[model samples]
Target: MALPESARLEGPILQELLALGGEERLRVLYRRLLAYFPHLDESERDCASARWRTLVQRAGARLVKKGELRREAGRWALTERGRQRAEAEKMLVEPPPEESPRRALSHEELQAMLVEIGRLLGKHAEREHERYDVVWKDSPLSPRLSHVFEVQVHGKLESALAKLKHAYDTQRSKPVLVVSDARDERRAREWLRPYFSGSFHEIG
Candidate 1:
């Protein structure tokens, strides 16, 4: 995606926050960057566009300290003052920059895509950070064949799961488990370990 010479991802961050219309945790925001988040740092440092999207996210995050935003519970929101300025400058309502195919999906959209792959007619799999890079096939030959995940790294499970359920309302597989971090991953693993000794597929 083409980031502005100055605001880079920070500009879009501001608009996304406005579109959100309420307080949002940084981790939640980070997850919204998903699949694109982890690679931000290792990208070209000289080029803001080159940096991993997560690095851009961090730059966007710095807006908080800059007094352009507000925070609570480690979450962030558009400050009334910032919102007012954005309204006048028209920064909060700009369209997103063009992006590569993968970059197009928001964090939630990415997760939805992952879960959709689970239901593919034949064997299929996809993976990323919060998970791993691996290849697997959907098969009854495998003992573990249940469970679905939308690899968003943030947001409360209640709303996340609700949105996910709304997307695909079939109980054909295990419920879509929404996790915030590794702790949740461990908890889920421990909880599911006893029942399914088979593979634990991840899509993050």
Candidate 2:
């Protein structure tokens, strides 16, 4: 059974949970909701019950369709517009002022870091080679590729994954996708599972 129709979970409350979690797998978010609303009937809280799950799932889908949330990699996260709404409603939790924010890395810097990592591993690494954003070779003279990286700070996820898939098919190089945030990384991981299968080994 689900919560009473009169006591149904509110959309804003779900958004608040997503904002608080930064990004959360659907199951985890559901569990958090149970904790938040402990007065609900036991039947509604039972994992075996589809009613509660259905309600939550529909609510999440509605938010996604409304452009206020994103469902990626089996996880849900607030979009920029969603965050703004949450903040305006004073539902978002403020971070502690004592902690300083980490500097966001730019696309070029991310590529540079990957190149350095490749070099440290004793492989020759270079940025912006043909269609690939970064690639590693055994040596500058070697024609074979070892690892291929696509740095995606902002752009189509399909485009980046497509290039990696091509590299794997032709060069048999290990494919890696680099993203600025954890959210994108998870999103990439979800997309990789069905399409790339195990061809792509890692996401950083």
Candidate 3:
């Protein structure tokens, strides 16, 4: 008996989806499959593209045949068997492990690692300063800080303003000033006023 369209494509599609951990939406799966094997004919990509709805139906049919996927509340999730297959395939391709270290880091060694990390970060920030309009440290209630860079172009200021507002809403701490510059300092100040609460300044 001749197989249906979805069933015909099932083996290759299932292999690809399993390789990708089998948790992707149909569209994402489709794109990744094409990216990995670009020679797959257009007809193959179109096999399930009658409509967006049809894509899921085709994927469902394919998964049903393998007995390794299930639909739960409009989302496809991998079964345990599916996860095992993915893991097996991954193990086959993974490189051999390197030799383990003789001993764990001592306190002095850990402190040296921290100092190296800070030096690398300072160099990275210096490079970013050369290429961007503004760079600032984003700190919250925690001691850790995240760096944010802003380039003024094509509504970028507006984008930065929105991001700053989001950060303020989510985090309870204030950001540090490492370096900053502005094309229109007044405009930058105006945009950041609501979010910064009068803590904006130049970094030396």
Candidate 2 has its poorest 10 consecutive residues by lDDT at 90-99
Question: Per-residue alpha-carbon lDDT of model 2 for 1-204, expressed as tens digits?
Answer: 337442244454445554576567777766656554555677667744677677778777777776877888887788877776666755343322344678889999999999999999999999999889999999999998899999878988778887988888898888887767755656756755765554343332
Tens digits of per-residue lDDT for model 3, 6-52: 54343445565676667666655555444333344566545345543
Alpha carbon lDDT of residue 75, candidate 1? Answer: 71
For each candidate in turn, the TM-score is 0.32, 0.46, 0.30
Per-residue lDDT over 1-204 for candidate 1, one digit per residue giving the tens place of the 0 to 100 score:
332333555655566677688457666565454332233344333332434445745665577778778766667788876676566656434654556554334665655566466657455654441232222336646544245455546555445444334333443334455443445567776754643443222211
Q: Stretches of candidate 1 above 4 Å error?
A: 1-6, 33-57, 89-204
At residue 89, give the lDDT of candidate 3. Answer: 60
Model 3 Cα RMSD, 1 decimal: 16.9
Candidate 1 lDDT score at position 142: 52
